[model samples]
Target: MSVQALVRWVAAGLAALVVSAMPMAASAQQPSKSSMALANEILDIKGSLQIFETVIPGVVEKSKATLLQMNPNLFKDVDAIGNDLRKEFAPRLAVLREEIAKIYATRFTEQEMKDTIAFYKSPLGKKILTEEPNFVDRSMAAAQDWAVKLNDEVLQRFRAELRKRGHPF
Candidate 1:
């Protein structure tokens, strides 16, 4: 496989591994009828428990960039590779969304799930629902930058303390 194809394949495998690691309290057995119904309802209202529509594409694009950076010569047809990656991941997304909905059902009571669905269905709630992914993406990016700086300072302080204790690097 080309570098782009190889990276996408690895990423898809990792996503499966991460999803498999989701808590299986409810998944350990068949879901109750009401729970299954509620899970379906929740999926209908929210589409997914987590934002994959934008996020997955973003990651794939980033991976494409990284792959090109590492070996630009290997993928002469970037668009074809991108389309292939999307096609590969598209089928798996539905299964992923259903799995996430089931996980949400296990974590929340039926009533709570209904309440959430209702909130998302409301007008202002609809606006929030539409804007939330973008808001979260920006907030998370800022947080990651902040965390990196904080981590560096914290690590330096701890290392200094260790050196003060007569430890050598």
Candidate 2:
């Protein structure tokens, strides 16, 4: 490349880097479309809900398996049992769905939803909304881990005290 073109290209690259690195507000930030924000929020919430949804099926399947395992003749056909359960409980799940929808509607205000949508439209906000579920889940898992440990410690202490008193361990 010619020296002038090389210098111009270098200058353009540096300018792009500096511009990208600057605060978004310093750059001419366009306002987000509320509909797009709402869509993304819905998607994010649905995605987060799906993340922890395995337990529902897992619990059901495990229960079914345990019932059959404990009593080999309890179910003539396990598949039939499962199908019957699905058919029976499917309607009830609508109740759960309504309950969950009501909870979300109550927990988040309409204005809060608008604000969240607006925030998620921003690059930083998008990053945060994307990362926050994982962050929250991990933090919660950490807290739960500690809580379990604390419960165990307390139970062990009580057990030891009982043993000291010549009660059953």
Candidate 3:
């Protein structure tokens, strides 16, 4: 390549790098503590988890029940379902925990998450977390019922469409 062409390419590369660095420089400015707290306030981990628990309930609890029925070695007290064996079942829950924590973490800064956790530590936050599981349990059960009906309707529509089009499977 000619020297002029090489110099132009280098300048273009330098421009791109400088543009990429702008976001990092702006983010490093560090939000104020009150801003962090506000972020914490707006970002609702408990509300999100309640949504989750409603969606999944305690897979561990259900699994332990199945385990006890199958083996009886686990779920000896029914409370052991929440015990160290959670690590044994960690693989199943790891992705869920990571994904959920990520939604909470990435939405806020470090100090913001800390402040959020601190709020959840108090009476109101603690209460929300405590009650959310049951509420979601009911909500998810209804959601499941709705999903079944939706699936049947979609299936019927697909079959009718295929028949009308005279498409052979």
Best by lDDT: 1
Runs with alpha carbons beyond 4 Å of true place in candidate 1: 1-23, 53-89, 155-169
> For each candidate, what is the lDDT?
0.69, 0.57, 0.55
Predicted structure 2: clash tally: 0
Global lDDT of model 1 = 0.69
lDDT accuracy of residue 148 in candidate 2: 100
Relative to the true structure, candidate 3 reaches a TM of 0.35
TM-score of each candidate? 0.54, 0.48, 0.35
Candidate 3, which segments miss by more than 4 Å at Cα?
A: 1-110, 166-169
Residue 62 Cα positional deviation in candidate 3, in Å, after optimal superposition: 14
| Residue 135 of model 3, lDDT score | 54
Poorest lDDT segment (10 consecutive residues) of candidate 2: 46-55
In model 2, state the lDDT of residue 103.
Answer: 38
Looking at model 2, the pairs that clash are: none
| Per-residue lDDT of model 1, residues 31-114, tens digit only | 567886887887677545334555467667888899889889767687578878877887777787667656666767889888
Of candidate 1, the 10-residue stretch with the lowest lDDT total is 1-10
Clash pairs (backbone) in predicted model 3: 54-136
lDDT of 2: 0.57
